[model samples]
Target: MKIAVVAANGKVARKVITEAIKRGHDVTAFGRHKENNTDASKYVIKDILDLKKEDLEGFDVVVDAFGTWASEAMHLHTVTSQHLADLLEHTNTRLLIVGGAGSLYTNKEHTETVASGPDFPHDWLPVANAMADSLNALRKRNDVHWTYLSPAANFVADGEATGKYAFAGEELTLNKNNESTISYADYASAMLDVIENGQHDKERISVYAD
Candidate 1:
């Protein structure tokens, strides 16, 4: 399958791109930076807000991994979500978003996420919450095939690429120790699985260690 990954320069995106290529899928990587070294040669250097429909033509899947948190939290989320929605609507392509863990709940009655709790970094709340809102907006659209993937609650910079994890829909998953965590590699693998198999369409799902 042919896949286009936006924000391909990001750490998480890089992993997805690499794995996609290794799995023998054709990939077109897009990013804002011209200096970044992405293995895919057919790279488009453009801002997400300025991306045109022609730029996204002929792709089986488009992964939206683009994000910014410098501006007002709500504005950033709204702008990013709008761009993604436009691409899906205009180009008529399926979308897979690298989402936040904040939208997942331990159960239906829970109002807060592990990321929004007192233990999470205060500076990260805006971005996390904004991503949750973005996912919410995407779910309301019935014309698009979309999946929002939330990583485990304690996702960190580095961990073993075990490629072993469990998935949960709407409800957050907990391990034997009652913790939610997954390596970036595993997260990327899970995203690709969604892209290839079209699982959990129009819904938000979470991945974590078992």
Candidate 2:
């Protein structure tokens, strides 16, 4: 499969690209900044909103790994997503968003999101809200085949892949120890699994440690 990753320089996006490349897929990396070193099969230096339809054509899947911690840049999550949807409308390319855990349901009853609960950290609220907004924007679109993959509540970096994970939809998942966590490597593995298997379409799915 031909894959394009937006914000390809990101920590998670880099891992996703690496995983895709390891799977023998043709991968193209898109980033807003110029990088001196990259391992992508192809690279594009352009803002997500600046991308034209021609820029994204021929890819089997487009991963929206675009993310920001700055409060001002948070809006990029939603706006860029809208642009991607418009650009890919009526095309066969699928849009898979690297989503957030904030909006995920904290309970099986779906009464509350992690972001709405008292446990959510106030410092990261802006980014979480932006992710929620991005998901909402994607949910409203009908012309594009979109899937949102939210990470575990305790998603972390540099942990072992183990090539194992548990999947869920909307609701937050917990391990046997009642904790929600997944390493970046395993998260990338799950993303590639979804991409290759085509198991999810027009839905939001999440994963955590098994």
Candidate 3:
């Protein structure tokens, strides 16, 4: 499959690009700052917001890996997402967002989210809200085919890829150790697997290590 990853310079996005290339997929990196994945089929240095419809043509999937750690710019998540969705609306191409765990439901009833739960960290609320808002915006639109993959509560960066993972719908998941966590590599693998499986459509799924 042909894949394009926005904000491909991010730690998580870099892993996604590398894993996609390693899995024999044609991968392209689009971002403004850096080109860390030399293995990509092409690297385009452009702000995701500035990406026109022509820039997104001919890709089976566009992965929204855009992220911001600063509190002030968190709204960029929604802005960039809307931009991509607007461009790809009613097209055959799928837009898969690199989502956040905060929006994942904490209960089977789907009333609560991770960020709303008591144990969630206080400092992570800003970005979590941003992520949730982005997903919410996508939900209100039916024009584009999109999937949101939320990593487990503990999104490990330097952890190993066990080549094993499990999936769930909306609800947060915890592994055998009773921990909600997954390494960046395994999360990337799970996402690519979702892309290859062609199962999810306009849905949000959570991934955790096995």
Cα lDDT listed for each candidate: 0.80, 0.91, 0.91
User: Which residue pairs collide in model 1, if any?
Assistant: none
Q: Identify the candidate with maximal TM-score.
A: 2
TM-score ranking of the models:
2, 3, 1
Name the weakest run of 10 consecutive residues (lDDT summed) in model 2: 32-41
- Tens-digit lDDT string for candidate 3 (110-162): 99989999988999999999999999999998999999999998999999989
Compared with the true structure, model 3 gives a TM-score of 0.96
lDDT of 1 by residue, 15-89 (tens): 889889988899998888886567776798887777877787788899888767674546656566567677678
| Shift of residue 132 alpha carbon in model 2, Å | 0.5
Kindly report the root-mean-square deviation of model 3 from the true structure over all alpha carbons.
Answer: 1.2
Q: State the lDDT at 2 in candidate 1.
A: 90
In model 2, which runs have C-alpha deviations exceeding 4 angstroms?
Answer: none
RMSD of 2: 1.1
